[model samples]
Target chain A: MNDQPAASGTPASGGVRIAVDAMGGDHGPAEIVPGALDHAGAHPEDQVLLIGLEAAIRAAAGTLPPNATIVPASQVIEMHEHPALALREKRDASILVASDLVRRGEADALITAGHTGAAMAAAILRIGRLPGVDRPALAVQMIRTGAPFVLLDIGANPDSTAENLAQYARMGAIFAERVLGIPEPRVALLSIGEEKGKGDLRIQRATELLDASGLRFVGNVEGKDVTGDLADVVVTDAVTGNVVLKFFEGLSTFIFDLFRDEFRRSLRGRLAYLLLRPGIARIRDVFDYEKAGGSPLLGVRGAVIITHGRAKRRMIAFGLGVAAETARTGVPALIEEALREDAARLDAAGAGAEGRAEETTLDPEDTP
Target chain B: MNDQPAASGTPASGGVRIAVDAMGGDHGPAEIVPGALDHAGAHPEDQVLLIGLEAAIRAAAGTLPPNATIVPASQVIEMHEHPALALREKRDASILVASDLVRRGEADALITAGHTGAAMAAAILRIGRLPGVDRPALAVQMIRTGAPFVLLDIGANPDSTAENLAQYARMGAIFAERVLGIPEPRVALLSIGEEKGKGDLRIQRATELLDASGLRFVGNVEGKDVTGDLADVVVTDAVTGNVVLKFFEGLSTFIFDLFRDEFRRSLRGRLAYLLLRPGIARIRDVFDYEKAGGSPLLGVRGAVIITHGRAKRRMIAFGLGVAAETARTGVPALIEEALREDAARLDAAGAGAEGRAEETTLDPEDTP
Candidate 1:
């Protein structure tokens, strides 16, 4: 899939390319085609390869930007599809093909509007993890906080050990400082309460390990704090984070729907909607995920940003911005270096486990 | 103490008196004073007593009811003070005095707006639990799913076992069906997901145990379902439910604050607020805890309704209404029956563990 198969490791002379899965997302080729065009149009110096069936891509792109072009692929991993099985069986799926472009040096990065699990899986399977990293995490830049709060393994590792949580805190902290530009970002373990014995056995044990981690740890925070910007980086197992994330998304929709119904009731109601429009907009913007783009599969060697399955033009544009910022800042390399240092310390300390990465049979690419 | 002691038997007599903690809550004397006065004024034939400092209770009662009079006590339980310790040490505290009224022959019930922990501790020590009840649960009447959903153990038994949750489910179902007038109240186990394995360990275990319970079980329901009138009784560990309760309170405030702020911004906004005002008011009124009053700490031998620490006139008034309704509905006798049946079943099952009431260490009258 690289520009030259013989030049997989060769450095590019100039320009950067991002591969986007054009056939994925609710809007499919229509939204992805224009989003890529819109992004590449804004940045003439960069190129974005639209990977999908060429005909579908062309039919969707009403008017194309010169820097955006299509590369053909026939399959797509649907949002509800089993991610791990799809990633393995459908190697030529748009998401897999797109990730391979970055893996094989044809592109600088990969972005997708497919299933987050599938995209993360494809990236790990294709690009592979950085040396010494136990498990990669999914980190997001919370625009509300204006500082990244890395929610590692958001759906990646639902069941984790204390060592895994500690490693997540270490990687997440690095992501914030390197990519998000926060110095010594505060780390917090998400739990039911602030008390030491508040949560279940998992969090209780995890807290002790995280406290001893080299970074500053803020202890436990509740669900509201996930979006409240109280901590710079919030760490938790994937299961809890997934529930919180989805609950927030559903809650935002519920509130918005209630308002819309009330707003359309009468002229006066519409007037109130207009009057209170700004404040409501502020609330809306605070919870907006599009502006935040997708979760980046951290601990990988290259940048891979995964947007929602309903990604529109604006979300895609935000993805390009995130990818550019991440690549420019060298977040993955920094994370890799940090992980190596942590592993060395763990070995010296004679901790509970060593050579941990080899035991993790499930790769990021095997997500389901 | 009550005018006549309640017989330590299945059917408690209606002639038994109850003492009101007349100097509790944020709006103190005013709310408690008026609430007691209102109860005395409304129930002319019933036996009720008021306990607090004489001067304050008398002063609070600008207009005294014909049947009610103040029983002087100097102590008060501040909301910020440690509840368990305070309840034990401050013998004359209104909550302590009121609970002791039941222990003696002064009253059959005790109602308070003091710290919840302190009040619960006082009741457990003074009046004690019913024969078969192991864990006492506070059954909250939540307006979710357009019905009165009995949320049991809402802020009681913070750390619970599988059997404790099952018992709460049974009690909650009984409360809803028997008191709320819901026929065969559907009981749902609150969870993160509808799938069997999709919640914390406690919930997963509770789900299995609850199925074996004789109550009308309705599988699992997510956070959204809590508001959609799907279940009559929702059972969860108190800690998770408390967070959900707090979260809902915060969310409601955040929404209204935003709306009110916008409405006050300009003339146009004010006009809009006026137009949509009715709908918004209905929503707020539907959610107001004051209207719901105090949640009864079920599973005890007698009624001990725990009102909010922030109780104002409206909440205190609601508390009176709750007390009146509970007095008329015979929730206490039903609790006693349930406990007896539970004890027999436990003995038959050969689960020869200490009774739940014994496990929950209660403070002595002199030591918290």
Candidate 2:
């Protein structure tokens, strides 16, 4: 019944297939299997391949929907294990199998709510990176001032250079344009102050590189401006972005909890809360990370979503939607093309002051 | 009939005198003069020296309170002027004059809401750094989970090393103990993740140093745990700290604005707002930077408060109060002593691995 033409390697009449790491996250198969089944049921045009230990997937999935199938893997990567080591030791891990599916072109995308480090490792080691891409960045879609913006390098490579940030700018712009649908995304460098001279040497160098690059560079933006829709894309080193993102999540939760406690304090508060429930829910949804599904591991050869470990069924279903959307847009291919163009521009500029830009070019052999 | 003893160069019976930068901040003398007057009016035992251009200060002063006096400064440093240059060129600038007052012991402390870089520059060049302080760190007091905590290096030195972080831990602990009355404050290094090896090399090295520093090092704290009473002192490089602090302010303001807009949407929402006003106000007050006054520029020879540039009367008054409290508690002296002890401990530990610790020792000639 699927009508959408196969974009990758599935049958011409088959829909986009998503490989899900069902043995991932805190709840393991119990949460992930049903989530995949639900998503498959909801979107009949898409298929889900649940990857995990065979017996556990069977037990947790119960009765799968028509579009859902189980792909058995003998091992599961635990959250605490070292990412690279675990991926090497556990070759048959669910995350690895899911990545392999995407690598082999059997699946259009892979979704994992498991260990972030492991998922990234598997994607890099198996699915590989897009051409002209050195490191894959985690691009998170967040809302600030009633508008959505993308923040990148949110825990990919902590020791990032100016070149890495510049690459992030290119990849992030592509993601913003194709996925977020913002034409000519305004990219900002996250620094301590708005001044070009502010922040550390790395930031200063990145500022120079971004300014010279042909992107719509909107100078420096501080942390205060991050949530104000000042730019379509905010770029930073993984350390800073990860910290800021977590802080945002934590503070939002804390504020909501404070409101909840205050509402329960008195009769007037209770009545007020009842009246304000809809408004509060609206605010909650605006701040909800789950609503955005999860961040994409940008610059990878195939679409991969690294969801939150605490994600529930609904969040996973939404993640499936995100993966499908990414697959449909073919963001990885677009990113590769953009990076190639960016590299060519840098090379044509004679590589005098833009030596850093030259270093970020993806390997030719890796090009699709 | 003030009974408080003079702490500095004031008369034996004179109370703490705080030199106020009357021409500083966005409102200039207009906001600062009234703020100083208010503080002097409320605290009969305290005196305020409002330093600025003579005519402007007098015009804004209106009818000065009993304990408030105006000190004429020929030059007023504009907010945008480079800090070090302004301090050198504008010899009689209000910020410089105020710092001079503290340096001469005519005032126990100095309060400025002007350009932060200029304030730090003026304080460092005029009042000088305490013995054993390589760089002065900014320490901000904030409330999270109903408990007061201190965050340091909140824009003092954007470029920092592991040694600077270790020094901050010492100074921060001292400030927390003496000012915030937290005994043996738990100090945590801010990083992207809680894992020991999660962040960049600087963070990893800082983590190792903190572990061996003999302080109550609480390992690593991610951004999410920074505001939840997870650590009594959260230490980070200036860039990260500044970004996180500003992000907190921005997010809090955004959430409040969201609430305000939601409340105005419908009649029931308006009613709920009327009932919820008290709770909202309480939340606002809790997150108010003004209520906590300005952050103290720690490790300086004299107590200097770097208040917000947009600070109004109430915030300025609170800043004066903070200055008085810092003077009363002898925080600078205590910090110096604690740092000295920490240095000696490191020296006794053979200084084999931590050679950087020796470079931060206070100059013997500069010691109090």
What's the CA error at residue A5 for candidate 1, in Å?
Answer: 17
> How does model 1 fare in lDDT?
0.68
**Candidate 2, residue B249: how far the Cα is off, in Å:** 1.5
User: Weakest 10 consecutive residues, lDDT, candidate 1 chain B?
Assistant: B359-368
Query: Per-residue alpha-carbon lDDT of model 2 for A201-314, expressed as tens digits?
Result: 777778777887888999778888888878999998887888899999888778877788778888888999999889988887777777778889998777799999998888
Fnat for the candidates in order: 0.15, 0.49
Best candidate (score: lDDT)? 2
lDDT of model 1, residue A283: 66
> How would you encode candidate 2's per-residue C-alpha lDDT over B108-174 as one tens digit per residue?
8899989888888777766777778777899898768676789988888767888889889888887
Docking class of 2: acceptable
Candidate 2 chain B TM? 0.89
User: What's the number of clashes in each of the models?
Assistant: 14, 3
Candidate 1 local lDDT, A1-368, one digit each (tens): 11223222222334567787888778888887777787788888778899988889999887667788788898888877666677767767998788778767687767888776677777766776677656677766643435446666565654467677787888788768766788999988776656554465556666776765678888877654555667888777654555445544544455566667778877867877877777677766655778766777776667778887788988888887677566656666677677778778767878764322221111112211
What is candidate 1's lDDT per residue for B1-368, written digit by digit as tens?
A: 12224442233344435567887678778778887677676677556577888888878788676667677778998877766567657878888778766666456566788777677877765666665566788878875425567776666664577778887887777667665788988988776556554455556666666665566887877765666666888887664566555555545555566667777877877877788887676566556667777888876656678888888766776776666556445666676676567667767867654332211111111110
- Isolated chain A: TM-score per model? 0.85, 0.89
